[model samples]
Target: MVNGPSTQMAFVEVDCLPTHRDLVVATLCRVPEIISIEVSARGRDLLLTVVTHDWTALSDLVLSRLQIDGILRHRTSLVTDIHLEASDWRLDALNRAQTLEVARIEVHSATVPSTVTPADTALIDLISHDGRIGFAELARLTQRNASTVRRQFTRLTACGIMKFRCEVSQESSRWPISCTWFCRVEPGHVAETVRILRGIPETRGCFSTTGESNFMFIGWARSVTDLLRIEKEVAQSQPTLRFLDSAVAFATPKRIGWFLDQSGCATGEVVVPTFSTPVSKKH
Candidate 1:
């Protein structure tokens, strides 16, 4: 059985020159530790979620690789937890097969109890490789019968251990820009802030993390004007929420562990790190 990742995860926010954007993305994508990269529509900034055994080493490596004249600045935050606000897993079987009209939202929060089982690991690995993999194929990969696989799948979903998502291309969907908003709210206001952000129609994912800016969300827009309108609406509605920073994804090479093709379908490459704690031995 494959042991899940036992180390900390990091979400690094980066800003660089638009001209060197491709070069920076190409370099970072080659690093195995980087699980996914979301580039802004203007190609001036990026958000990288990296899984590694050592946070310090990973941060240093990122700085070294991206430190250039075009590189304006960067910051790395240790992700304490990840919360899935919405995705295909939250939908019924029929909805899971339908195309997504918006971006999926995942929030990073403080550490929580580890929820990993052999079956959960198997399901995640298989689905990460193929988001739309059917039950029969999943059974074949996990060495279980169809019935057992289906039962485990249901259990995993119920327990919130993992979820599957079907992403559509921005061009096809007519939402050409994807933006992630990092907001710092009063300690007691975090939950309310998240709720407000999630309620927005543009919100694809909403997350709470460990840092000054504890709330984050990904929202979609058709253009810069539309994005500004969304932000304006949020500001007027939620005056208590302080906006920290935002990054627009021009290209997403990988999202939620699936290596994406130009059209945003899974490309058979899964970089998702498993999280499982070792079982204690009895005396």
Candidate 2:
């Protein structure tokens, strides 16, 4: 089991030839640490969510096993905080209010059980494919009654084991220019810098990670001009922040365990592989 709330997480971007996509996914899914995998719409890269008790071993595994010849490049960022934008719900007012309401929930120390029951696993498998599935549908899929399934769903959400969010596609969103920013901030200013980034309307997600450039954020733009403008505004507003690099995301094939189709809709299919053996500690 994970060491409770202190479990460390990392987001990795893997760039590879299109031909190696499935191979890459298959290889990564076999690794016990990877929790989620996403493919870009363009199909050239993948995003992975990894959980580990030891960052050093996890880094070694990623660098050795995941960086095959066909793989062009890969970048890993440690996640300190994650902010999800609810663009699909179109409930900006409600979302903003709920965001504040949930502010009391600690970010860095949220505990996710390292082990789960079969029922819990089934529920997670079903919901990951379709976060909006009706209770009746979930009951049928999980071989449980509607009431039981509903209770399980509620419990999972309440415990931070699961979350339901709107996934918007670049082609459909008003601000379609999606990019990830790798940033460096003054050691003392990391918290303030992340706060400012989260407050930006275009910021879809932001995180603090371990590395030379210790921060990363995802932002959207309506056009190249808008993207540049946003970048300039952020730079001006937070003088302590420095951009190390940025990468444009052309696609997101899988998110939070759901496999996405060409139109960027969740296919209600789970592609992330599971391991029968418990995760072993390298340290």
Candidate 3:
């Protein structure tokens, strides 16, 4: 749920030698760049969500750090545009009245900024691990006054550099199947194509990426059979969109900062992303 300003994210497919799959998964888990790891069923062995400070850093991660033993091959797709995020989606728990009431609330307080300071970095580092950490505790950890910490936290959120999400075990949530679709459409119809995908109820996230498949999206399904229905719906919605490939996540070892169990429940462990250098303030 935590993100940084100027962060670059990519979806990397890794094919591990069958015998070394467990070992490889364990090794990749320790890398901070590898924010999320999923065992895929249809296309690749592992699907990874990696974030870096910039494109150069991302290239270094894919070319050097990710070149570990037991990984037979890997492919990286850089995200160019994000149409939707998981945090933006909500479950169908609320009724009409409750949903309308919640929607009426204003969440944004401060104006978004394009840069962050050292103070922002400290706050982000702490909240990235525990989003619920209080202002007092954050002050104690960061060695700043509580009031200042609160102000800085507000600024960070306003800048869109700090965001929070509550993640639950997908299995427990009943939508156990996680699928990622790779598709492509004419450049002229990108906006229309994304609009059609967003109308699908199962869609969790949609993004434009740099690859043979320009569009990628995620969907959570009640069952494998439901995937067919969703795919058909997508095809019917946008005839020009071509499906390059699709991968179903059989297991997710990590998601964002939380380490998930086999049932997709958090194990109370977190891996906060490490920024190699503090963000410089723009003049």
Window of ten residues with lowest summed lDDT in model 1: 84-93
Assess candidate 3 and give its lDDT.
0.83
**lDDT (C-alpha, whole model) for all candidates:** 0.65, 0.65, 0.83
Q: What TM-score does structure 2 among the candidates reach?
A: 0.70
RMSD of each: 6.5, 5.9, 2.7
Given candidate 3, what's the lDDT at residue 120? 73
Q: What is the lDDT of residue 107 in candidate 2?
A: 36
Q: How close is candidate 1 to the true structure, as a TM-score?
A: 0.69
Tens-place lDDT digits, model 2, residues 1-283: 1122345678887888778778877676656667656565442377777766555656676778776756888877777654443321232545776877756663333445655566876767666555668998888877789998887766666656555555665567687666777788776987777677767788877777778778877777788678788788889989989998776656555554456666667666665433211344457
lDDT of 2 at 119: 81
Best by lDDT: 3
The TM-scores of all predictions, comma-separated, are: 0.69, 0.70, 0.92
- For candidate 2, what's the RMSD? 5.9
